[model samples]
Target: MSEFRDSGTFQGERMPKRPNIVWFLAIGATLTGVAMPMGTPAIAVSAITSHPNQKSDPPSDRIAAAMRAYLRDLAAKEQFTGTALVVRRGEVLVRAAAGAADAEEDIPNRPDTVFRIASVTKQFTSMLVLKLRDRGLLGLEDRVCPYLIPGYIRTCPQAWRPITIREILTHTSGIPDIQQLPGFYIKLSQPTTTRELIQRFVNKPLDFKPGTSWKYSNSGYILAGAIIQAVTRKPYGTVLHEEITGPLSLRHTGYSRRNPPAGYAKGYFTVGSPAPPINGSQAFSATGIYANADDIVRWDRSFGAHTVAPPATVKQAFTPQAPCPSNGCLNLPSSAYAFGWLVDRLHGHRLRYHPGLLQGYAASNMYLPDDDIAVVVLSNVEETDTNGIARHLATMALKSASAHDH
Candidate 1:
């Protein structure tokens, strides 16, 4: 055993000590008293080489650390207050929560915090329509007017009366945006039945001939939701819960108007001196889906796994049906409308993405099928650039994958 002792030196002066001698009978020479000086060069050498200081990070960990640091800096600079998640082939690569869920309470956002998904809910409504088609209970080719209330398409031009479910899913039904109709917003605040909602727009005129052009009309999706209700004999929300959210075990996802979960971010719009909170009602089917980043990822994965719709049906949802004209599309450089998703190209990679913006909440979800990458961003701020953040995260996740490949 080796033992160490501290030897103090005063002004570089060495202290002396007495030595002892030992005699051996068989040895020719006697063991004489010998003085071995302590704190010599050998002791100093061992102390210097004992344990060298070094960093603990491996190369992969170092890269991940740098990426996290950059994300933190970017979030702070951009004033991003949301949760971001990145998953590759069903494996979570990164799940980070930043900023406050409720700014007033100073509660930091968490993975399970839910927010109104806004237009992202349209995808779920579209999926329900496609599922019904797969079950042979409905046909996309059937004219929607016949199944709906009488005069449902009377306001549309005579040429557009033959609009089909496929046309509505593809946003080519030529129905006007409900928000643009007079009294639509006011009526949205009220508990209007699906039939009443349809009747209100029955006499409205179409913007163009059906299937001749692409125009995103919320009324078209609401009509689809109503059709789901009519076919299933259940509320739209209940169908969504049973068909989509339930089988996936998405506990944090739901359409609720009563008490929401704790730590939920209050939606805010910057209008007056201080932005007022926006609490959306439960009646809106074209837009209302309350979920978090984690839940959204699960929802996206359901497509790849064919958990909600068949693989072919899911494929149709991400395939561009028609080119979107101005005033109805987001103007993505390489994007077009599919069943509900926006099919586009990002950095030469196919992307299925969508953004949801309501009164005080904004959310975005993106999936790169070729690379099996998906990302979701959920924010409470109505005007936040959440699409930009989602793009950045997707880029980072892809970059991480490329680096791993090398």
Candidate 2:
């Protein structure tokens, strides 16, 4: 269970400024009349203090100091075992790592340590879908069956011949959850491609009609990744690197297939006994992206500054598409899954968030648009409450930011 507490109430602060690179791209794209696919927002430049070294602490370091103390307490309590990054506008406000990157090796966690992002990778896949739509290569309204392998609709009585890209993006395609698949957890040891995985279960019946309701389906995002491949004739990793990671200089982020970086945490499942390390290759498009807290802060800044996709596209991704049967809308107290994010409200702040879980890894990333704050938590323990840790830290960060603003 996650615990979130906002100790003090304060007015919202101004949105932070974008880096020069973001401004240059935005202006260049605007001048060329080329749509800047970046969806980051522009805030007042005062939110961030300029410095020669990007790693240098900000001018008002109260937030960072508070966060560090909080993290130290959390680590001492065994409540967190990963890196946490809190940034406002484009400045690195609080960047701290706790616990161990490699628990067995006794290596201390660092801000640059990479962990498997798990379902957080969905956002990247969703971004690719939006990019394709912007380029006219695809449409949210387009049917999925036409682009997918044949007989995809054979198993679903309610499923029409096709599912839309929009349906898949919003998890309304009525596809069965990946957890429901037979031997899904056990099959992680085997090498499986996106095509093979889809072929194995594409004919399965739909849980509901496309777009009628929302359900969290990893299969839909996997299919979305496959769609990227089918249209671009390139691997999903290549597309992700060229389109998103490379441009942003997210050097620590990647879809690792074989060897991962040194000091990386090993994934483990505490089944009957502790399970062995899970490889990144097992996750493929559905998960598999590796990154650290600092890199994700860069990602959030890009979103906050409108540096990647246009603001309109980013809005579409965050906006609730179809109603969730239980909640009736994406606006709920706890996190409600958006296209690639878990949409929610905290202390009157709107958030776009997502959490990732694998055999031995857990992660969470969230963007609070109201306060221009983004929090990312990455852990090695498989079933650890990463979201809870993120929320706790986020609450603290927001409180500190509010105090600083006053």
Candidate 3:
């Protein structure tokens, strides 16, 4: 919300269209050699640590000038409109924002500006599910149907009856996304309950049989949220608060079922377009959270510092769980997925990440465990290349971090 650069702005070529992997893919890899839940080993697990005041993120002069200029160039073209941040270990290497929070009010984006994290919210949901698993309240491999008191109610042509929680996390459950279902917008025009949202698609048949295939499904997460509620006997939001946010003190993060919390960014399909309305009830644990760049970094660090779970389970979620097989998997190296994260290798380094998109928000939260770096990006403009920006900045930071190694 303050000045990025008042003297002059630099111009670089606009960000190119990388492969269109934005929201179409599942969660991905990180930690090339850290240990996760299943006895898998990733190398850099020893380096993941955080101090009590890891919030100090002074911009590092070590970051290349071109990287900073590139973000500025994208903003100058009205292509970028939110916050981007890079944290290596516990230090902030790059922190910047471009464009307005409310274009009508001419609010500038800032380091602390909140944005709808969209599907990145899934990572949190996944974490909550894992926490329950660790406590022996539920098993990850258990069938989801038994947890639902109302049962799996969907009208799709398939007579499928069983889908495991693991299958849901890996996008192999074959449940069709409730949002893409024919009458999603009508059913989602206003607030609704998790059970009500699931009811709308309860009778739908399976898009694909569970566990044999993979496809992104928001309804699968709705089912997951329902499972959480059924087990805890509390609302998903309440559980998220008690189990996750409250412990972490993530003051800026929430389930965001009604109006976006005070001081959050107003999303737009285009720069001059009016803000779009959201049905938070429809999103639930799948995509109903709002957060700032700083809180997101804290979330990342928590996972690294073993604040979330034992090392092995953390690695399991970050570990690549499914195959790419080009079934609409975005073109990437080893483009497999995991629990609410995409676990893949880019440039021979393990990367765990997820990209989220909503009506007017685009977000990507990525961690490169081999490099001990995490990138958090939130953009209000729907069309902005937030995922690309995160990828490019992480690549640049890795390069810089590599250069300093000598």
Which model is ahead, 1 or 2, in terms of TM-score?
2
Candidate 1 global lDDT:
0.64
In order of TM-score, best first, we have 3, 2, 1
lDDT digits (tens) for residues 81-162 of candidate 1: 5666666655444454455555444444544456778889888888889888888879989888666654233344464569
What lDDT does model 2 reach? 0.65
Candidate 1 at residue 335, lDDT?
Answer: 52
Model 2, 1-406: lDDT tens digits are: 1111111111111222210101111111111111112122222222334433434333345555566566666766666666666665544455545554544444445455578888889888888889888998889898776676542223433364667888887888888877568888887766666666776567688888776777778888877887898888788789989989888777777886654566465564431124565555557777878876666777776765677789998888788665555653323344445678767788888877888887777888888876777788887767667788788778876776677677
Give, for candidate 1, the lowest lDDT window spanning 10 residues: 18-27
Could you tell me how far off, in angstroms, the CA of residue 340 lies in candidate 2 after the best superposition?
0.4
lDDT measured at residue 375 in model 3 versus the true structure, 0 to 100: 88
Q: Against the hidden reference, what TM-scores do the models get? A: 0.77, 0.79, 0.82
**Per-residue accuracy of model 3 over 1-406 as CA lDDT, tens digit each:** 1222211111211222211111100012222222111111212112323334434222334363456667767776777778776777555555566666766655555556678898898898888888889888899889777787554343422344577888887788887788787767665547777767877666777877788877778877887888888888888889988988787767677885786566577888887675566767777888888887767877787776777678987887787778766743444334787788877776778888888888888899988876778888898888887878888888887876766665
What are the clashing pairs of model 1? 268-360
CA displacement after TM-score superposition, residue 76 of candidate 2 (Å):
1.7
How do the candidates rank by lDDT, highest first? Answer: 3, 2, 1
Off by over 4 Å in 1: 1-67, 150-160, 183-190, 257-263, 271-283, 326-328
Candidate 2 TM-score to native: 0.79
